[model samples]
Target: MGCTGPLAELGGGETVRRAMDVNFLGMLRLVRAVTPSMAERRSGCVVNVGSVVGTAATPWAGVYCASKAAIHAATDALRLELAPFGVHVVKVVPGRVKSGIGRANTAQIAGGHGGKPREWGMYREFTAAIEERARASQGAGATEASALARHVAERVMRPRPPREIVYGSLTALFAVLAASPVWARDAFFARRFGLNRKL
Candidate 1:
């Protein structure tokens, strides 16, 4: 299951709820609706498409990252629970596979203000940077969707599917960040997102 949107410019309640609905709850609803049949059949593969940011909270996109992180955790639990039923739960963590998510995110954020900048409490000056961060994954060196699809397809078809699959641009960098100390991660993201500097 794949889903996403921009939440950096939205208020706390709206941002968190929107991200949770799309990134985490949507998958839960899908599994709830479909898992019974799969369990009955005693064979199935569920592939969840998450993001590298889910592994580590990045500045400016905390809501979206939180939702993805929930998916990562849920997927782990799902993998364990479904194994005995011959159901394979695969978590595909994509760093930045080329897609229209960036455009959609930009559109979603802009829709709230007719494509004009809206008042962003406390983060007023960093609006552009936040927008850039939303589209950052689509920049140069992003992995093509076809390649990611092929890789996932090949893996899921195996006798023993991987519990977690990580790929796409900046996958390694983000993985390292996810494994780093909290202080290091905070410092890195603060600097990268201009949070450490005065706007």
Candidate 2:
């Protein structure tokens, strides 16, 4: 989900619901869809693909961060809920996996703004920065999904798996934010990424 969105994809309502549905509800839906069978067997690993956004709020990334934070919360609860049934729940928190997800989100947001003037409040607030976030999400230094996947693959096979494993360096930074105070973290995120600059 890079850092932000186009803010107009659904054509009418705010894309807030869309973001929540995809990033939060979708994870729950998948777990509900699969957990029963695994419980019956008393064996199975459910590694949720979460994000750095789940841990801390980023500039231009409120909705995505909120939804993902819910995902992490759900992952933790589900882990305990399913533990009695012998289902292993591992949360995979990837930092910046270079994937089409970023590009698709960009295109969707960009397309949504077309024909609509840039003066729309949300668009004016987010347009250029979102474009940049998407671009940077795919750029160098962003950890590859395969690397994270390998870690997850190993974790599931282990006799004892971790509750959460952070993959990227930037993700670790977010972890620091997650543990820090609101003002400290907020100020850190706002300035750490150079978000204070003009769009």
Candidate 3:
């Protein structure tokens, strides 16, 4: 529900701050507030559900990706830092989720696409179709949050647990790409977004 649309001309510093506050700082503040209690117990687990955007910065969604990327990095470090104290930090990253949240965010961005009133006129056809396609594409299940909860629960009970764990198809695919060379990963997403420049 708190996603952005591109039409807000939301490119200024204030907009950036608003996004960072909600997407990055909001989670961070929550964790910070909770950490003291977790530390006091000397045994706690924190699982942060992030997005593929966090891992892979997508075009036209730079701010979203940036926030996500920060979370990923923070989670990774926090996982290690928390380990010795019996606190576990796990990050679950998913992709292309047919979520109302995703739809809302995409629509938000699409609404702001052209950047200005005059620019909107130019972007009408493209933005309308993008919105339509976005609406049409939601509702498939690429991930199961309940299953993710089970996995996290299992991790919590384990005497020895992983520092970081990803969930579902997006995580799996990203892992495959990660193991491969950079060029291959580049080709993969390039093909996906039709951004491959084969001139």
Number of the predicted model whose lDDT against the real structure is largest: 1
Model 3: lDDT of residue 89:
84
Rank the candidate models, highest lDDT first: 1, 2, 3
Candidate 2 structure quality by residue, lDDT tens digits, 1-199: 4336433442324467777787788888998999999999998889887788777767655667677788888999999999998898988787877778676656655655564432335456655665666566567787777887787788789887888877874776777888999989867766755556565
For model 3, residues 138-168, the per-residue Cα lDDT tens digits are 4465556567668767875676666666666
lDDT of 1 by residue, 1-199 (tens): 2223234445466556766897799999999988889999999989987889889877767777788889999999999999899999999998888988788667655654466634567777777877777787789999999999998899989988998899888999998998999999999988887778855
lDDT of 2 at 156: 80
What TM-score, over all chains together, does every model reach? 0.89, 0.82, 0.71
CA lDDT of each prediction against the hidden true structure: 0.80, 0.72, 0.63
Clashes of each: 0, 1, 9
Residue 9 in candidate 1, Cα distance off native in Å? 7.2
Model 3, C-alpha of 132: deviation from truth (Å): 8.1
Candidate 2, residue 115: Cα displacement in angstroms equals 6.2
Regions of candidate 1 where Cα sits further than 4 Å from its true position? 1-9, 112-116
Ranking by TM-score: 1, 2, 3
Q: Where does candidate 3 clash, by residue pair?
A: 4-108, 4-109, 5-108, 5-109, 6-109, 6-112, 6-113, 7-112, 7-113
